[model samples]
Target: MQRAITAIYRTRDVAHLVRDELERLGLARHHITVIHKDVRTADPNAADTSGTVDPADGIVPAVGTAGGAYVGAGMVPGAYMGAMPGYGLGMPAYSEADLVYADAFDALHDLHLPEEDTRTYQQAIRNGDYVVSVEVDEDADIARIQEVMRRPEDVHDLTELDKTYRDAVYAPRRRPPREGYRDGMMGRRADLQNSPTTRDYIREEPLWPKGGTA
Candidate 1:
């Protein structure tokens, strides 16, 4: 089986997360190499199933060697990192999910999709969708997604994504602020207005005991 590593993140947390996922998926530590780009298609035979294997992810690793190592939050199946044809943009792509397979490299690219449907790509474009070449130069494989977007004349205020995000942000809080302590805590006035004991003490002053006048 061919092996590779791709770090689809800038921070160590992302690297760790991908590593954990790979390990969880049964890719051995030795079979893994870490870098900044996906390398599933460098070889005509090697493959990536993460849905982001692009033609520009640099060179292919030798069979049994980890392909490429990198990190990114948008690393999805069939994600093609680097730049490619017909984009007409100056900045390169930032996010690309490497779709690895046991057979060969499959490319995924934006531009072909409508502006809205290609969000994950736009996010990568704006962000530093990292692609560090380990054993080869990165090439963003350009592939098109075959999905239909259903635009409506009305707004979708009830989208699940919106609801979930709002729920997470504005959910009823579990606990409230501390309460239950409001008494005199100040100065000469506090002495007069404070605890019942303090009032009693003041009333029994020696100079004016009970109803006695001096």
Candidate 2:
């Protein structure tokens, strides 16, 4: 089994340099995977006129919106977390953490890394730098590639790669609150409950009546 030796680079230039060197050292170019931030590909939510829905769209995104429904509400101990049948409060888009992981591990399953290194490579790319992972069949190749890619100022292992990436990318920055606009779960719930039509329905029949006022 081949082991993956991976490192993160601060720049695409250096990442390409190391990749070329790895090829010269006898590793095949196809054996190396380069991961970097691509602005064009970053926005999965970008308007898609293509009409093809990504399968992941159903899995990861639906988890949040459907979580409440799956858990159930009204008399259930965890009612607050669950959605009622008619309650269409809202669903959240993907979070930064989930998207980062998804992007970092894109197509990684096909690379066939050794079991131990799979975890290492997955965690190393979370910082969002140009990450390179090469499948080397020999221990000697791992040593050579590491030497070729290691920077004098950094630790060379995953830790230093993560540090370099964090320094380069500022992530999960707070979006400026919408001025005078309600947002987030509370806002969405309030909007749903207060809508003229929904308000009438809730008042007349109430999906989950509180204190017999329905």
Write one digit per residue (lDDT tens) for candidate 1, span 183-208: 21111111232221111011111111
Compared with the true structure, model 2 gives a TM-score of: 0.41
Residue 111, candidate 2: C-alpha displacement in angstroms: 4.6
Per-residue C-alpha lDDT of model 2 across residues 1-214, encoded as one tens digit per residue: 2244556566667777777887789765545556543311122333323232232211111111111111111122212222224222332322445343432343332233333434444544554456565544433444456577675443235544334444333222111211222221110111122111111000111111122210
Query: Against the hidden true structure, what lDDT does model 2 obtain?
Result: 0.37
lDDT of all the models against the reference?
0.24, 0.37
RMSD of each: 30.7, 21.6
Identify the runs in model 2 with alpha carbons over 4 angstroms from their true place.
Answer: 39-93, 96-101, 108-127, 153-157, 160-214
Q: Estimate each model's TM-score.
A: 0.20, 0.41
